[model samples]
Target: MNRTSNPGDNQTGTSQRPFRVTEDELERALRETLAGRVAAPQPLAADPAAVALRRARRSGRRRALSGLALAGVATVLVTAGMAQLGEPGGNHGTPTVVLGDPRGFSPAPLPTATAPAPGPVRAELDLILGSRLETSGGEQQELTNVGPVERAQRLPDAGGWLMTSATPAGRTLWWLPPNGSPPQVLLAGADAVAVAANGRQVAWRDGPDLHAAGLVGGQLIAANQTPAPAGAEPVGFAGDAVLIRQPGRGGFATWSRSAGARPGPTAPNVLAVYGELPDGRVVGLVAAGKPGRPCVALLDPARDLSPVRTGCGPELAVDGLGAISWDQRWLLLNGAGKAALLIDLRTLGTTVTAHPAGPPVVAGVAWTQTGVAMHVDATGGLVRVRPDRVLDGERPTASTIDGVAPADRPVVVADAGA
Candidate 1:
């Protein structure tokens, strides 16, 4: 709830800074910080699981804060923390215009001024999806130069530190590079959001209409959604096609691409919702009459795609590559922890023992790039690994292989060579 001026807002004799945080407000500050980190903050899901976990985690602290007693004890601490954020000591990054999209999102009043950013913790690299005309990650404390930033679309579950950005014209898109080159800009923006790593294909939303088949062979292949059957709403999009939820039925249809017939072979009641994978493959969960019993299926339209394999079992991984990404190539899935699979997408083979004998990955297999930058989520400073080398930070080493950004957040820590 504190505010700092834009770091470089100095005109005449005034200087600007970041908000320092305090212990009492640590939780809120942390949440706010993370929320700002992502392109669009995830909506708080309306379910028992989400609420229950939140309640359990805060019960004790809530109980201890008797009325405004703790509030009185922490005023100065809060101020100090805000100052710490803009203290002349931390990493300072380039400026970016952060668009705040609260979940359950209703339009709110815009602030006359922008929120002050904390001193940089990482480098001044452009790692976020909406960070247009900017640099982030890499430094802290130093002042940032502000400018207009835009992100036509944002998604959190695509895995790793990833977000998609579109140009002002809404034509070209630049993706975060796994290798050292600049981000890839394409004329892509359409229904749902699409971003492919291995082959580098991307599509997202612009205004309300969808843009598709962009930047192929250096040309833009554009397509528009030509109205649904009067009642269907868009549910998901893959490549140039979109899946619309049909009215009064438990069915979904691929519109536009229409390459595949509606209600094809798969019954409306037993259809799967396929999402595009990082490697350009389709994956979906085949639902059944039994609400609790859904199965995972790796789909390949190019192939038979007739439910290749079913009942992957509950032992499957949450962060496991989407069934479609898995279907795209044959990678060994060890079925243990996040880092269990050592895959060579080129060979469609397994490398085994990708993780260097360590504790389990409490966090999901949070990948930055497809397989380039990886991390092990531990309590205090987890271990981060990248292609060609492992960096515990005790040892930072660069590599010939280009690394992906750590997450949509930023590469807080990288091997010396990354």
Candidate 2:
């Protein structure tokens, strides 16, 4: 029997192509065979070359599939990484991971938000006169014309003005509202009046009786009376208590709704009480003897009137004329000389001596709502002295307030109510 040689046989017994099939047709046939739509017919006898060829084709197909699968996995990983990096157009930059020494690594603190500081208080200038009061803005109101006004002060809350003037009948305490309302007589024979720094309570002395009342809507209500020592005058309010200056005694006494009357600060050297600080401390003058050199002292009423701090100097020879800033951080003292001293209570030693221009006379001194220390010179010029800059030991310069005449005295309207 004669056997025909197979065309697929090679010298090395490897596979050889007997007929050509395009790549598309082979791929289709492979798909159809896997899907079971086409049957792969088996030969009665298997050819070695044909079997090897099929095995090689399968190996190549598997390799191609593996490469494609790896590429797909790489693409998926790259897309996920970009998504975690956030949007493209942002402030974010490339991420960097630092592996620092365990002992030196410290995470940065997160940022925080803060509220803005409030603006300065709004104040007005009152041109006080014997029979009338005029504001710098041209508002006018007539006064009782009780002989030249003796004492006048803007309420701590700027609710109104408190004035004490002499009448033929006797000394009278008057209240003038800021709205140009008619003057209201608080006490006909009122000896001394004191209003709390908060502008809520008022205390006045009428003869031997001490009167206390609540101030609401420019009216006095819930009146309370207690018998006090004759000639005792109210100086200020200590919480809900009235601080009274004893006539014979040099120290002060306290009277409240709960406590009728009680002895106050036993300290014998306290000569005068200027005002109350925001912290309830009283700023006063302390001296050893009459006409003796006086010192600025902070007396704590809560501590049995103990002296917290004291500052003394020739410039602090206040002639019983001074004004404390609304914040109680500054004290302006008009000395015996032409200059006035501005003292920073925070540092009792820091002082600034302000001299007026045009004349050596400093008629009066006050603190404006804007924190400026103002004084009227003999020329009636409104001299403004800032405490902040002068507190640094620098020479203070004065600026004249426009539209104020040399004969007119300008007083700042205290707007502490807000």
List TM-scores for all candidates, in order: 0.34, 0.57
Q: Model 2, range 225-264, lDDT digits (tens) per residue?
A: 8887757778778777677786654666667655455545
Where does candidate 2 stray beyond 4 Å?
1-124, 144-147, 153-160, 257-259, 263-266, 288-293, 349-365, 377-381, 389-413
Model 2: pairs clashing at backbone N, Cα or C within 3 Å: 157-417
Model 2 residue 38 lDDT score: 38
Which window of ten consecutive residues has the lowest lDDT sum in model 1?
139-148
Candidate 2, residue 61: lDDT = 82
Cα lDDT over the full model 1: 0.38
Candidate 1 lDDT tens digits, 236-330: 45554454554554545554454323322223542444355554344544443355344455454443233443443433233323222223332
For model 2 the local lDDT of residue 132 reads 68
Which regions of candidate 1 are displaced past 4 Å?
1-191, 196-202, 205-209, 216-219, 222-224, 228-281, 288-292, 300-306, 315-408, 411-418
